[model samples]
Target: MNNGYFGFCGTPTRANSQNLAEKLSCLHLDAFARKRAEKFGLDIVTTSWEDNARSKNSCWGPCITDMSLGVKEDKPHPRDFLMSMIRKPNYRDETCDTPIEKFCVTVGNEKKNSSLKRITLKEFLQDIALYTDNNVKPMWRDRDSQIVTSVQA
Candidate 1:
């Protein structure tokens, strides 16, 4: 998600729905998140970063049509399985940013059976960027981003 500011924050979790939505919305506004979301079958278009005040100017693109995994029969990835299953499947539109004071109270209520946890959009995008740039290998293993932590002695 990057948020165009902080570096890697962390993966999304189930607790921070509003923050996650904000991050997603910000990322959607950028070129990088749009490209990655399309490739991964994520439903990014429905989200609106702006609340009612800015809804008229918000952008709406194609909705995510494919939520299936890359593997045949939509097999779940190892990491995906380890994360929250019920909450993991849930996704938020980036454009849904209504201030609590002005908007309805029930808008961002927490869910009981979500499969994924809420993570900062920056972390989410970082994860996707890492995979896209390095063929899914962690940054530590990437030739360009790898750091020399070992001592010769």
Candidate 2:
């Protein structure tokens, strides 16, 4: 949680009677964390992932979505098997101004890439300002100011 700057950062899903980490983030946690970060003179990001998962009590979104290869299902595209099963997220709000703290992408396929597919992924990242003005800003830039530090490994 931003190196102790945050206290109760969590993911989209809450546990069904689970540990503190599984507990959904609430006002108490946020206020405490905010106060602590401020007391430390830190401007760290402190937000939890919204519960975009469709099921109310599922342990994992994928388990609820239950996407499968569907080997026997008549599929139009190779990716369609994975895509058609999961519920797409609707941010509840219509605007695109939500600030992104981090971006993580995990792909199961490790085989050769198609030129068309590769270009699409490249375009997607570029559209999100992931390159950060050609490296002017590093990722997860969640600070009030930028301080370039030199560390010896």
Candidate 3:
């Protein structure tokens, strides 16, 4: 999943600033990640955002929703394998802050017997590659697209 920037800076005029919102509205990192996941034959299950501080029960920042691989039937209990991605931005005003991109995989119920690991997007994809017997390399492109590199494992 991808996350949207709060806003943009360095605009010369009001008109430019207004246009920035429109141009950037569709440019989200989660969307790109979703595309990469789909390219690898993973099925998306759901997309939702996390609540911010102002919202009720707002502990986590805004984040994209959960996705599933649809491989539950192979398991005895029919538990769905799920994944979630979060793109965290680093605000310039926040000293020493760095951007964070993380992906988490869950094999069973989130509340029980689930193997959840939060790792870098690259590491997560590498794990996916190992799991699926496919060598996966995700390349960043402009907001419009992504380049996926895959080799049979």
Error of 1 at 12 (Å): 15
Off by over 4 Å in 2: 1-17, 20-24, 27-30, 40-104, 109-153
lDDT of 2 by residue, 1-153 (tens): 245534445453545334332232232245565466457443222221223343453334541222222223333323212111111222221112222323234332333462322322323343435423454333333341222111110
User: What do the candidate models score in CA lDDT, each in turn?
Assistant: 0.32, 0.31, 0.35
What would the per-residue lDDT of candidate 1 be over residues 31-146, giving only the tens digit for each residue? 66455545654523321122222233344433322222121223332322111111111233233333222321121123345344554333433454432434463322223232
Q: Which parts of model 1 are misplaced by more than 4 Å?
A: 1-21, 47-153
Q: Who is ahead in TM-score, 1 or 3?
A: 3
Alpha-carbon lDDT of model 3: 0.35
Clash pairs for candidate 3 = 1-30, 2-29, 2-30
TM-score, per-candidate, Cα-based: 0.19, 0.20, 0.20
Q: Which ten residues in a row have the lowest lDDT in candidate 2?
A: 80-89
Highest lDDT model number: 3
Supply the TM-score for candidate 2.
Answer: 0.20
Residue 23 alpha-carbon offset, candidate 3, angstroms = 43
